[model samples]
Target chain A: MSDTKTKKKRKEKPPIEEPLLAPGHRACSGCGESLGAKLVMDAAGPNTYATCCTGCLEVFSTPYPESAWKMPWIHSLFENSSAVAAGIEAALIAQGRDKDVNIIAMGGDGGTADIGIGCLSGMLERGHNILYVCFDNEAYMNTGVQRSGLTPFDARTSTSPPGKRSWGNKTTKKNLPGIAGAHGIPYVATATVGYPNDLINKVKKALKIQGPKYMQVHVPCPLGWIHPTDQTIEIAKLAVLTGLIPIYEMEYGEVTRVRKIGKNRRPVEDYLKPQGRFRHLFAKGAEAEEELEKIRQIAEDNIKKFGLA
Target chain B: MARPRPAGYVAEPGSSKANKTGSWRTEKPVFLHDTCTDCRICVLVCPDGIIFGADSIYDADFDFCKGCGICAAECPVDDIEMAPEVR
Candidate 1:
């Protein structure tokens, strides 16, 4: 029995001897962003060069004296990671080594959706051979959980607190993938940390395609979202399962495939109730029910729009 | 012997294993090898990289395991159990 079990385990285990991103970085205990980034790195492999914007990933992975990256990595300014990646790609082409290496630029929602969108748009429009990855944790988590352009509707943040006059962030999450798709990139995909295999496969697929590519991965922030540290993966999965976040792939401004939620579709409440940022929606009385209805409608719209059902 | 080093760039990768982050846990996951199906899903999903062991004989290093229970949640066999830390 023991021998059989051992054999089965060995077969199931992944061959991960030398990870591109070495283990030993200063990320939070259950940070999905770091884990998701690690998955992306593992998929991209050693021959890839990555550029990061000033955010949690940049701060934790490449702290001045120490770095977790085993591959060539660069830390660019908050609004210029894509620009730096473009420059790197241009330099690689000048050396006639462009085809040999994969270029990746990564940033959080704050950097990607807000501050860095211009450079990102320029890189896409210019058709740079780089993959832009946005690890959307929904807010600016590194700077004490402030509201960003990607922060969901009615969600509480340090800047968008719920009080008498206001009811958290009044804005909806920006459609970053849509914006990237509008640039007519070669490939675009949306993934989350919950589905590691899918995320890895998407990264691998994106890397193989030439020209500009974009992948937006939903990384659940335990600190910012105010959920149990262990439930990071669970919460991320729930976001997709509830249709609040759609998983799909696009090519040249058109969606090529959609990862359907199918029969196990969950209600939006299942995703919102666990997060403290959305706790106000579940407060006393039916005052916030209207907001809850609006959120449900958003999910329904995503389900219909992406054909997730 | 002393030598002047070049400025910029980290020469060596920092090993976070030296920092025992287990104290931050309010709950801990206890692995039940008997019930474990040897799927190894937990090993792949663990963010801390503390869960170690090849095949059926799997174990977590309490010194570094922050008890995220990602292993438990990802376990296809439901072998790992999350118990509250006494201390």
Candidate 2:
């Protein structure tokens, strides 16, 4: 028997995969948001303290006292999670208790990118030792799927309801990575729920670093997106394949790495057709192709601008 | 009131984009003189139409560069690096 064989033989069944986020919470079936939360918690470990903003995640996952989180958790306002996390982090520093525990501030894209953009910016510039994670479902899911700062242009959210007059969200989604990078934070990364390993690895890496880190992850909302429960991962992967979303990393406001655009670039329709929000795109003379192309240009600009070919 | 960084070591851009309106470039690449064997890994990897010719053009076109650090990460010689994007 070789030494390598003995080491390989000792690797036992991967410990049965314990459920970090226990069942019985109010998340919908095959909820990518919950899956994202689970992945973050798993990477954050038991001693992590999470400060969540109000949204579908905070509302559904931790209703009242029945929180699915097994660790310390706090929920501030719908848009002030980042500020609260900063305050809590300050408290931790005052108590001389900065080691071992990880401080994570989480919220949906609506909370982080739209309503809380100011707070998020302030926190990043202050250089607080924390990890800010935005579970981007692309729109304001909790407020009946309204247009948000992260909402893709031309997506039929309730507020940006698609019609002959309006083309969903008229303005382009704000680039949070560019904004955060501008703050010169130590780390900033874009990830998605479709790649759990990459998401976990980035989280672990952020924990080891000394300064604040930002991770924006794409999560598909089956209920709000009007998507099939099972297509959560499928849709997420499609967003990356097409030019809808580009995954990359930024250090001190400079792009460090960019995941190459997949060779087989699926038509943007492939990503849009599956969701209900984009149903208007199929209407007569929709002209969604032209609008979707603009979205593609945005992704391309990031790729070219950041060299994420 | 904050004492700014000395001009030598580049710092990340300390700025915001919400107020920023145009197609302004972010991310700037710098040279790591020691590790850089002058290998054009950065020049080759740059998807943006920046970086100079192999005859040692030593050019980094900020206008088109967009500050994507493909050059920095792909630099096997570690000669290329990304400076903090200070506005």
Cα-based RMSD of the predictions, in order? 2.8, 19.2
Q: Residue by residue across A104-195, what tens digits does model 2's lDDT show?
A: 99999988987888899889988899899999998888768888899887788888888768878788778888888889999999998766
Off by over 4 Å in 1: A1-15, B1-8, B14-23, B83-87
By TM-score, the best candidate is 1
Candidate 1, CAPRI quality class derived from DockQ:
acceptable
DockQ for the candidates, in order: 0.40, 0.01
Candidate 1 collision pairs = none
Tens digit per residue, CA lDDT, model 1, A33-69:
9888888987898899999999999987776666778
User: Least lDDT summed over 10 consecutive residues: which range in candidate 1 chain A?
Assistant: A9-18
Model number with the top DockQ: 1
lDDT of 1 at A240: 97
lDDT of 2 at A146: 80
Please write out the lDDT profile of model 1 over residues B1-87, one tens digit for every residue: 787764555446434334456787778888888767666677667775566776566887787667778888778878899999888
